[model samples]
Target chain A: MTLSVALGPDTQEGTRTGTAEATDSLTAPDIPWNLVIWNDPVNLMSYVSYVFQSYFGYSESKANKLMMEVHRKGRSIVAHGSKEQVERHAVAMHGFGLWATVEKASGGPGGNSGKSGGPGQGKGKRG
Target chain B: MLQPEERAGQDPLAALIGLDMDVAEPTDRAVKRLLPNVVKDDGAASLEFRQLTERSLRETKIGALRAAALDLDKDEIVLTPEGAKHWSMALNDVRLVLAERLDIRDEEDAEHVHLMQDWSQAEDVESYLALVYNFATWLQESLVQAMLQSLETRR
Candidate 1:
């Protein structure tokens, strides 16, 4: 699956902050945002799992695990880092018949958002 | 109640794979059970809305989660989180049986019939349908609400 895109300055900041030794993140020092997938009714759990597998190329068990997380826990942070990059991810999820939103990673749960609400699909809290 | 196949005395496995009296009951029960939750209407949902979604849930492979390996029963299918989006789009639907087969007749129904016997109970249609009841696009939209609350947990 092509990850949702949420490209922005914050994502760059995060990359820079995380890996001083790494060029990819250090050169792009923005706080990474997250692409969160919330539970929904229309798509089947398996179908959602398939999108993660087929679209994202996640292994079958990994895909099912994510889908199960969404089902059992109500939501799962499928991807993290970079507002602009996460936003792109959000769009891709929407196209595939999944419910997705992008937000700045929270300092707490997601560990990817720079703050509680950064910038992307919605600036609200992670569900 | 539809007669429990007065003809299935031959193959127990075939009989098991085929829809039985057990299957027929849930068609009525599934629609009755899920319609209120899904449509939330006093008036009955249109036949078209009920039929299509029912068929879609039963027959469509769950492309997202890869759990379509479960052969769903009437009670097994309900609107998916995304398919629920069509509810408003299909407001014209008035009354639906929510059965897999379009025809009430047995032969056509038999073609679409899948045996619950081969399925995994943990991921059966019943559980999947339950998830469908809990799922909604609005649930996704409402994550903002959940986000705020989880933030409360942290603080």
Candidate 2:
């Protein structure tokens, strides 16, 4: 499913700025989207880690770290790549019943610049 | 909770529906986990969202669970795309409820569940719930794999 949501004008502008910032990064400019999973009361910590490992093929320790980050910080950027790839990850996470979203790799409101904010901040959306 | 022979019988679907009904009834822990507040800081908006969506969401899940149970009773257990989605969500709901009831909060708790030997050796409520939790997890994992396989074929 192509999950789309309408954003306010200001939010849209912010997303553009964030996308630009992501593109300007030195290490890699092609990967400008992130797949983020948010913390929720329903999913178990271990289960989340297991999903990360099984789906993404991350090492156990790395999956555990990402799961812990989501648990402690309310969200974690699980993957970063092009829009299509990130959306695929988001959809897979949703298939596992995780609250996931694809957002531009830029910062979001509430002082959550691209690096810190949870998944849906750029679009203020969900999948 | 089901034996190998029993799993092949029609009773499995009935048992699954029974379990779904039990889960659908209001229980404090289940309710909190299944219909968690989306907006944490705003009490008013949270309450409003729950009131508006909770009932429908619960009903949808229940319906899906029941449908999946019926589907399992068929000769082939084939799942349509919509059935796949519903079954996945229903299986997740079951896991979430089982996890909450079992107090599976973190890695240690989940590891303890994994360490359990057998349901026949279950000495207490926690042990019994651990078995259920593990079974639900297995079920969900299998369904997820099946869904992924189908996605791969479509691609």
Candidates' lDDT values, in order?
0.39, 0.57
Put down candidate 2 lDDT per residue, B16-84, tens digits, no spaces: 433222122234765555554434344443454343344445556667778888987788877787787
Interface RMSD of each: 17.2, 11.0
Provide the fnat value for model 1, as a fraction from 0 to 1: 0.00
The model with the greatest TM-score is 2
Residue-wise C-alpha lDDT for candidate 1, range A1-127, written one tens digit per residue: 1111111011122223234433343233355555667663233443465467555666555566667667656677776566556655554564444656554455335344343443233332321
* Candidate 1 segments exceeding 4 Å error: A1-31, A112-127, B1-155
Worst 10 residues of 2 chain B by lDDT: B1-10
Worst 10 residues of 2 chain A by lDDT: A1-10
* Candidate 1 accuracy as TM-score: 0.33
Cα-based lDDT at residue B42, candidate 2: 42
Error of 1 at B13 (Å): 64
Query: Each prediction's DockQ?
Result: 0.02, 0.09
- Tens digits of per-residue lDDT, candidate 1, B1-155, equal 21233553555654444322222213454233222211112122223222323323322222322332231334554545344323311211110122211222232332222222223443766544333322322333233223323333544
Candidate 2 regions with alpha-carbon error over 4 angstroms: A1-37, A40-74, A77-127, B1-27
Q: What are the root-mean-square deviations of the candidates from the true structure over C-alphas?
A: 20.4, 13.8
